[model samples]
Target chain A: MVENRPVLNVITHLVLILGIVIVALPIWITFVASTHDAVRMTQAPIPMLPGGHFWENFTQTLLGSGLSGTETAPVWRMLLNSLAMALMIALGKIAISLISAFAIVYFKFPFRMMFFWLIFVTLMLPVEVRILPTFEVVADLGMLNSYWGLSIPLIASATATFMFRQVFLTIPDEMLESARIDGAGPLRFFWDILIPLSRTNIAALFVILFIYGWNQYLWPLLITTDTDMTTIVMSIKQMLEAAEQSPQWNIIMMTALLAMLPPVFVVVAMQKLFVQGLTETDK
Target chain B: MLKRVHFPRSVLPYLLVAPQILITLVFFIWPASQAVYQSFLIEDAFGLSTEFVWFENFELLVDDELYLQSFGRTIFFSAAVALLSMSAALVLAGFADRVVRGATTYRTLMIWPYAVAPVLAGALWVFMFNPTLGIFPFLLDMVGIDWNHYLNGTHAMMLVIFAAAWKQIAYNFLFYLAAMQSIPRSLIEAAAIDGAGPVRRFIDHIFPLISPTTFFLLVINAVYAFFDTFGIIHAVTQGGPANSTTILVYKVFNDGFVGLDLGGSAAQSVILMVLVIAMTVVQFRYIERKVEY
Candidate 1:
């Protein structure tokens, strides 16, 4: 709104349009590729526009085995696996983090700071750094090839707990005193007062964690040997490898689109919460 | 840090924190200690035995040319990704801030890519540049530039950097835009009244105000390029052609999981842990400083 000369305004719009195009070109190409036939996709200078085979590609990718040569799970099965994993991680992390945050903030227990530091240490050791031993631990527990195997290890982090802890610290002490005067026990206070108060924070964290769980690649790649346990995000790698020989660009791109759709949908649908969660957690 | 009106000390607190503690001990603490321990013990190829060889793995890592090269390459990769994405996001965010209409629409279009997983980002980029069949290669041929990332090491690095940066632009843009919008409008308007143009105003006033956001994003993007781009590298080049694209994290996975060099891989993991710890300390320190601001 400050001194908007005509030339400056035009340049602003042009730059923004260019940025949008640069940002969107990859997805557009992926979509166009997904809509074409496999044979058409294999040819050079692939169609810039979407083809008539959108329904065919969607059904074939989602319903049938992804690539004919590949021994991968059905796309729907992988999507279901992804959904299960995302839901488990989001819900599990929220549940444990809420309770632990409540305990740390609202109870003067022994070793409270010790527990806080212990949880804080997880922030430094991302799973990538300790992949091997972590895999061994998970394998030893016989959690491999299962939903628990997919999610529980990843959930053992402090980001959500820290976020919830921060949120709890901001609540007025008067609320707790009032709740106690009303004879609300610890669990009752947490369930009735704390949970509703942090509703937006919970929703925001869930959005971030859901996308995170859905997009997990390396851990799932390591643990899920069985095709039935494969998630859609992990399946894209398999499909890409398959494409090297078969060159099923249409189906491969279709699978890629499907793998990303759920998380991307969540982000776009809950843009406000996603942004809040991202900014809050990182801080 | 406890509340003034906290619940009385009881076993209930233990019950409340038990699940998080249990998972943390089993998964995070135990495995991390195992990584540290395994780093000191050299395991034979067949898993038949492990001999305690304190400091040998670290020594080897220090002397190993490939490991040293990967360390350098990782730094280079992180720096390049950070610079490329941050600058692009800064420009886009700056312009987005100036636009009077459709800013939200542009923001929505710009930020959805943040949800795209690194692996999927890699897949999308790799498809567009797949040498023989890729659209980019076809276009590059018009310019007489060969575009085979499969064979060219530099091209492979460029491909990975681009893919990583492309995914990160959305994140940086959002942060930069938010920071830019938070600047007092009067400052820019005052500069405008003083006959400074938009670009001049940004450089003189707005940019300095958002340096904190810039610094925070530098660390965030560096950590991201360090850890999160594993998927992108795995999908795009698999550290390929001649190990040109192998960053430290990828090397750790390849050596441990595929080559089965348990001791050395564990040592690499330990080194990465130290780096992450250092970075986390720096980030937290900066955040503390930011709070003062």
Candidate 2:
């Protein structure tokens, strides 16, 4: 850029364009596959171009049973399940993390560091590592096949708590003192002063956590044995497996598109917040 | 780390922190301890008996060929996915950072895949490469290459790897691009003025400046490939065609749920837990060191 080499500039653009193509190709193919009928999808050399049956596939996928022979909830139902789960997880995590972070940063409490370490241990024990026992615990609590089952166990986030803690630490001590001088209680101070100050962090973390909750697969797949409780993300596997027998590529790909739409929309529409939350939380 | 003007010790803070501690205790710590305890016990196939056989399960895992092969395969898969996705992202980020215009446009296009569920990503790629009706195999037929991932181990591994890496590229790209953008422009301009070409500047100045990010991303990507790609592998191959694509996580799930090998699976889970703990420690240490830089 400094030397203004036209060839280098063109090369950069070309390479970027190629990168975009590679990144977008599978999705493009998915879109193309979704636009066709079931019959056309079974043939060799599936359509690269979009077919005219997009609405037909969309309607059938969203309204009708997702895959025949498989006892899946309707696509719309699964979408609703995904939405509910995502919102619950995002809100639940933000709520618990906010209060805990408030406790850690603003209030002196017994066993605070122990509690922090407890939450820290959760970071190392992803559900994947504690699969069978965690399933047993959830089952023992009679929470399986429910929203609580879907979201509660996954809601304790060390990173979000830590992020909020970091945000609160950077706040001036004067704010707390001023709140205390104004006779604000600890809860009142947190609800008004601290919450308002960390609004952006909360919103950004929501964006990231929503995508995370929406995309959850193994946990939901394990807990929700009830077909009606199936999340859209977890249903994709059923469709994929059912496709082996029935070869409903059109319907399967349409379900795939619908499952992906909300989170992808969140990422693209909330790009700035998404980027902020990602770099901040993961780092 | 508490604020200087913190509230006095009170039950209010206990109330505030109780929910997280409760959930962590019930869900994480309890289950983790259960796994550790179960790892020391061998359950009968009919669940009629469980014997406390400390170190026997671990010993079995050590001597088990399938477990060892799975261990090796997991390392290979993690390395392959991390290397492929990170290098691709680094190259794309390098080029994306060079763009004078529409960089945001390029980035927006690139990063939305990060929001796609790993299973959905796998489904998309598996569909694209679905042996019979898939367009890729159709094209490959012209070049006389057979491409059935369902039956072929190597093809299945390649399929899962591609799917895993494809889903990860968006994340790695986002991080790499952010890292590159954070490098001081003055350093780059100075390198350019000193007669270094763009590549030379990148190699000499830009890349070195971003090595911290590279290290950070390496840990992240490794963790991702280890734990997060379960959905991808599950949806795409189910560790199929004779357990070809079965990484450690998949094997744990399969062994516990499907194979009903509770003790073996619990042992694997404990090992994975230790692995995650080690990785988390490494990450925190690296981050601490990174702050000094």
Candidate 3:
């Protein structure tokens, strides 16, 4: 196959190289800028070589952002808070979507389509669209600045629900029927049959939800008024904003890079599931 | 009340849907109602409080220069990105559907940007557009056209739209490509044998087959553009260069969070919610059914 079509293969490689360049250029620049010193960074064309200012820039940023603890921005604590918030969201959304999907697909109950459509509607009314009112609701609920504020409202992801429902619809009907014939209830059948059969899907949804939760900024930023309660992305955002006033390219870039590590790690680790998940088409 | 009790089977679905229902109610429905209610009240656009002066917030928003600019820019940015990205994705996905080898690798790299957070994508672009040492400026300088997003409104919004679209076009490509691959190859083979050239074959056969995914993405991307693109706008332009890049969500952000004009923000948010609901309902009722298999 490789030897059969040299011209076609070359065109493919050429286009792909173009794509790779387009994708990598900005990211590559970020890495380069993160290594340069503050003074040399302002110079013409800037320095591409890794400089000695990484530690100085990172430390100053850490201390300057008051992230060095002491009644100020607790970086580690906030990271933990962000992690906990993201994880809970991922977990809550996954558990709900899986069970809801299993129920909707397998059960012969009434209004299944209604329930399905209700879930689908959220796909349209995404959290951001209703963010203002949602914030007011959170405030009214007495959940503002609490962990629940950071988690609940945005965590019930309709996209995940719809995706899981789509996948659940794909589980062979005979598989469900046969399992039911063996006297398995919905829970038993779901736990014993559907879930095991949907390992690729579960892995896929896990990564998808994890990414979604991790990348959440607006809701978290809106609800958490205190600087001490910031997510990593919001923290980087504040740094980037401040860097605008007092230019610290290295620190901003480094913080941005660090902010990206967890999701990039998620992407790299679950690249397989992601490919399969995105590439899987339903009839 | 103990007259007739439902079985566990009947009650289970409600049980499953309760949390989502409650959360969606509290977050989406109730707040939306508040926003709608609030939008009717009169208030200063920059202030935090409001009185029951009827049908005025929307009227005020209609007349406000910055608000109008944000609205127009939102529509333009959303429509342009959706059209450009969807078409590009379709063409690329069509070509990608053919190659049996390295398809996984292609898919992997293609969807990579979708995973990059919008905030990060925006920040990355901001870095790339840095006036002094940014790649874009450096490239433009190489071409003899000095470019700076910070100094130009058009450049600012253009970069903002492109940043939002870049993260998504590949995602649309992946989904559409998967859909195209599902089209029986025999159909295309038959089209080929029927005296159709590659272009003709794709135009007549493969194109219609993937219309459904294209249509699905059209609405999804429209909703995404209309509602979810604040991170890019905020992080990259911050509605700067004289408010050229300020979209609706960014406006909502600024109004509520930054300016503390909570009622006004809620009003804008409500208007946005109504627009989304109407669009989505139209999609589900009409456009969705147009999708082929």
**Cα lDDT, model 1, residue B156:** 98
Location of the lowest summed lDDT over 10 successive residues in candidate 3 chain B? B1-10
B62, model 3: CA deviation in Å? 2.9
TM-score of chain A of 2: 0.98
Misplaced by over 4 Å in model 2 are B291-293
**Whole-model Cα lDDT of every candidate shown, in order:** 0.93, 0.91, 0.73
Q: How far is each candidate from the true structure, as Cα RMSD in Å?
A: 0.9, 1.0, 4.6
B213-235: candidate 3 lDDT, tens digit per residue: 77778877888787667788878
Which number leads on DockQ?
A: 2
lDDT of 2 by residue, B1-293 (tens): 88888888778888888899999999999999999999999988789988999899999999999999999999999999999999999999999998878999999999999999999989998998888888889899899999999999999999888988998999999988888887778878888888999889888877888898888888888899899999999999999889899999999999999998999999999999999999999999987787322
lDDT of each residue in A1-283, candidate 3, tens digit only: 2123567667766666566566556667777787777777777676556777667766665556532222336455666777888788888887887777766665556777777776666665666766777776788889988888888887666767767777766655677557667877767776787678877777776776777788888888788878667787777677666766667677678767766777777776688776665444221
Can you write out model 1's per-residue Cα lDDT over B52-163, one digit (the tens) per residue?
9999999999999999999999999999999999999999999999977888899999999999999999999999999888889999999999999999999999999999
All candidates: TM-score: 0.99, 0.99, 0.85
Docking class of 1: high
For each candidate, report its DockQ versus the true two-chain complex.
0.88, 0.90, 0.38
**lDDT at B246, model 1:** 99
Q: TM-score of model 3 relative to the true fold? A: 0.85
